[model samples]
Target: MNISDQLSITAKGNPSKTAYIFQGEKTSYMELEGAVTKFASSLKELGYEKGDHIALVSGNSPYYVIGLYGALRLGLTVIPINPIYTVEEMRYILKNGDVKGVITMDLFMDKFVALASDFPEIHHYIVGDTGADVSHAQKLLNDKMKSFTGLMRTAELSLERPTIDDEDVAIILYTSGTTGKPKGAMLTHKNVYSNAKDVADYLKYSPEDKVIATLPMFHVFCFTVALNAPLMNGGTVLILPRFSPEDVFKVAKDEKATVFAGVPTMYNYLLQGGEAHKTDFESIRLCISGGASMPVALLKQFEQAFQVIVSEGYGLSEASPVTCFNPLDRPRKAGSIGQNIWNVENKVVDELGDEVPVGEVGELVVRGPNVMKGYYKLPEETAVSLRDGWLYTGDMAKVDEEGYFYIVDRKKDMILVGGYNVYPREVEEVLYQHPNVTEVAVVGAPDPNLGEAVQAFVVVNDTITEDQLLDYCREHLAKYKLPTVIEFLDELPKNTTGKILRKNLRDRVTQ
Candidate 1:
């Protein structure tokens, strides 16, 4: 079945139920289904045939959802782009993905207009006006330009979904190019739908659940967990424009949100918000954590402060973004990504692709229906990632005797200090234990004497000297693992998903 069929089924059972709540505005299941159908019909009228590529670049909004589901409903491959990308950055994705059209917000109108002339393949432009005025230069482009709202209203509603095979590619999610240029991971309809359904089932999602959709939908984690899983389960999604600890807490308490999902950085920020800014998370039944590993200290602190339990999971963009999550029915392990979810299998293996013994650190490999079809137009990269049947995640991890997986760090992020391997996450975990440290990211900086030295970038909640923080790390970490330098900043850099950008820290320090 098509992914859009989830809405139709939910609407049939709960037509009047709230499907999405954005900025206090409510859209019922039936209404959302109608909008998606109308928008899909409109795209069809523009001659966007099945298997064509259409890009959707925008922040969290109702229009983004409509565009996403509409494209999927008609079997068009949706390319999700971060709206903040520069003209050059977006141009690369559009050209690489072979995008035939784009649906972007008015905020990005200028960028598109500037780059439109370079790509004649993009024939249609649907602009979502988020209270932003459009540019007058729309007449310059050869493509037809129309407001997204206008199309949704004028197009005839076609409840009939186009024939979409389960194996048809649905979304092409580009990776955050920390290592090199980004490559799009082609997620098929079955790949996404299977993961969403399994995620909803694993999390014990019910129709009564109200999920906080704070993470950007462009990323696979939020696309499947916060958006697709909730929709598939007939739950309500409370949409937030962006992640703000204060705003998230207020909305959770005000809207009575039952489930909240976010990354470690968000959790640290929420913890740093302290008692004064703390919202009664009494309304939240369960909190989900991903994008990055949650520091064990921060996880415990937040649980105590907010009076809620947070289950952390692990996955990359290539695996339909979810391979393992802490099961709701079992005892949630503190730092473990938990066992593999239903129908998914995970193993920690060495360089030879053979599984290591329990408690041995190695690469995490996953195999399941949820795995992506392959990387778009990059067969060599796809072959490297997908071997035999398992997708090598390139994440250093270990599984306990109970089969709970613990992410050690990204293999590329491991530091070689004086020929001794040091995982940045181990040092960051020590730094997080400090009373004053709110957030920390560790990286390797060039050191003539020792090959490489450990340097830490930290965000502190209290007035603490760098020396003192380093001294605290010294006490907890081994001599080799201790950070040699500590730099205090107001905040650490993060991606749209709130994952701490360690590569950025290394770049700053090396410069």
Candidate 2:
């Protein structure tokens, strides 16, 4: 079923129940459905035909969900852009996707208008909020956009959902590339629906569950796993437009959120939020971690402190993102991404594409309902990623005899130091074991003796010296897996996706 139908189902069952809570404003499922149908009509009024590319550039907002479901309801392609992206980055996306129109916020209007000078393909620019008079706004959503309260006024929408098959592309989510020109993953409706179902099922979400929306709506992690999954299960979502560790606890406690989804850094921040011990966080029953591997030490400490275990999962942009996750309602696997989900088949293979024996490190490839249709307009890249219906995820991992999978690191991010391959993730894992090491990233530095020396950029929790960290890692991990050179950094460079841009970190250090 289409996502709009899911929202409709929830509206029928729980019309008065809060579907989304953001900035003290709540929108019921029925209200959210009415808003979406109105916006879909607005798109129709603007001559947005089905399959037309609708580009959205905004942070996580109640309107973000409205635009997303509205566009999909009309059978249009929704391309979500990172709100932090510069006009140059957005230009490539606008022109590349041949976007017909945009549904952006007041804050992004100026930057978008600047790109319009170069991108002639873009036509309509619909501004969302009534707070500002944005340029080229077809109309403003007014009070509904302002407070997310009131009646859903009908817009006399005539736009019919375009006849789309399971294989038809729904969203073009751009990711990867060092040049900052993102590669768009063309995900089909079936892909998103399947992944959402798998994750919702794995997490055992119910109508009674209230989820915290920490991750950005643009990111696939939130779109499929958090947003879509909760909607599919008819659960209430407490949306956070921007993350504030202090506010997370307050919102969770106030909204009585049951399921909380977060990245490793967010989890760390929440731990350091101070009221963690005092604040009763028992409302949060299931916590899921994605975007990066959860540090074992952090995960263990989190469980001890919060009385909730974090189920670490792994995915990238190509698999419509959710491939493997730690299964709920089963025996937990510490430091592992648990088993492959219900509709996905995961296996580790060597250079020859043959399955490696259990416990041997190999590239994790998956065949699943969640796999994307292809990379938008990039046949060669699509061919490389999808071979015989399996997406070759660049992540390298290993499986145990009990079918538990452990992700070693990103294949390209693997550092070969001292002629002995040292997976940075392995070293980082050890560094995380140190109580004082809050965040750490391992990268290969130019070394004359060893060709490439392992260097660690660490963000310490306490006053721990480099020697102390190395000694701690040495105890937990092998010598070769330990960092040879350690430097304390305020923070490591990361992309919008939260993946460490090791190349950028290296550039900063070398320059």
Candidate 3:
């Protein structure tokens, strides 16, 4: 069944259960379903039919959830965009995805007003209420503008539902590619629903589980694990507007949240002042880490300070963002992403698509119902990524005899120094072992002698000289793998989801 139908079943069984709690406001399942129906009906009345594409650009809010399910309920493909993206980035997706309508917050009305003249094919501009006065923008938009709040309040919930198939595209998630324009990954209904169900089952979510949603919903990691998994299992979701150490701590204590998910950078932040708030996460049983590799040192420190189990997983946007998670029943591995979950199959393959021996690093590949059908409007790129029914993930990984998988680094991010393969993650892992080091990232720097030299970027809590760090690394890393230059930063450049932007670091070296 599609996600909307699954939500309907949960609502019918527990109408009064709290579906989500946002900004101290509680929304019951019945109320949430009612709003989704009304919003879908209003879109139908506005001439938006099945298979139409709509862009949802907003931060974490109840309106974001409503707009997502509302569009999916009517069999329309929803393209979620980061609200902080520039006009150029936003325009690329809208124009390339062939979006027919847009649902955004009133705060961004001015941006739509600027682009309306260029995008005449976009028929509807539905703006959600953010308490901003959009009078001038509305006047500019004229007949094309529609109020998000007004549509749900006035529209009836009697619109006919479309027959959505499992193979039908539901979401077109754009990947944050390092090199060129982003590629949109078209996920089918089965791909989304199956991943959510498998994740909920693997994590052992139930009606009593209250999953914290602090990660950005626009990203696939939070979309499936934090938001969709809980709802699919009739659980409560605590949605924080943004990720902050104080806010997350307060909400976890007040609401007794059972599960919390975040990236490695967030885990580092929580560890900075986490000792005082140890009791704040007493009710939390599980902490999930993804988006980037969790430093083994950081993971152990956070787990000890908070006294909670943190499971690190691996996924990409093309696979509904989840394929493997550390098993809760077994002794959790520190650096491993754990075995493949449920129906998904993960293997490490060499360049020729042959499975490599255990304990050898190779490109990771995945095959399952969760993998996307293909990239939207990019057949050549899609063929390169997806071949023989298996999605060839560009991540370099290795598996253990026990079937646990460990991500080494991105294939493209691997550095070649004097013809010897030098993976940055291997060096970063050594640097993270320092007591004063908080976060670290390594990249290749241009060099005339060794062809390319290893460079390190580090964020530390206390004073540490380049000589001391290099001396410490000499004991662990090989002479060829040692970094020639070390640059200290207050914080690393990261994307919206907090993954370290190695590409940006590489660009800095070239400049």
Candidate 3 per-residue C-alpha lDDT over 1-511 given as tens digits, one digit per residue, 9 for 90 to 100: 9889898899989999999999899999999999999999999999999999999998889889999999999999999999888888888999999999999999888788778888999998998898999998878888889989999889997669999999999999999968899999999999999999999999999999999999999999999999999999999999998999999999999999999999999998888978789999999999999999999999998988999999999899999989999999988899999999999999999999999999999999999999999999999999999989899999999999999999998998999899988999999999999998888999999889889999999999899999999999999999999999999999999998899999999999999
**Superior by TM-score: candidate 1 or candidate 3:** 3
True-structure lDDT of candidate 3: 0.94
- C-alpha local distance difference test of each model: 0.89, 0.80, 0.94
lDDT of 3 at 257: 97
Candidate that scores best on TM-score:
3
* Residue-by-residue lDDT tens digits, candidate 2, 1-511: 6677778788888899888888889889888887888788777766788889988877788778988998888888999988788888888888898898877777776686566557556666666563766534223322112212221244753445567677778899898566456789998888888888778887888889988887888988888777999988888888988787777788888888898888888888778774544355778888889988888888888888888878888887778788888877786888899888888899999988899999999999999888888888899988998988788988899999978899998887787767788888878887887778888888777777877778899898678787887777778876766778899988877776466778887775566
Model 3 lDDT at residue 75: 97
Report the lDDT tens digits of candidate 1 across residue range 1-511.
7569878899988899999999999999999999999999999888888999999998899988999999888889999999888898898999999999999888888888888779877888898987776656467763478889988879997745678889999999999988888999999999999999999999999889999998998888889999999999999999998999878988888889999999888887787775885565878999999999999999999999887899999888998889999988878999899999999999999999999999999999999999999999999999999999999999999999888999998999898988899999899888888888888899999999998999998888789898888778777888999888898898888777788888888899889
- How far is each candidate from the true structure, as Cα RMSD in Å? 1.5, 3.2, 0.8
- For lDDT, the strongest prediction is 3
**Model 2 accuracy (lDDT, Cα):** 0.80
Clashing residue pairs, backbone N/CA/C < 3 A, model 1: none
Candidate 1 stretches with Cα past 4 Å from truth are: 277-279
> Residue pairs in steric clash, candidate 3?
none
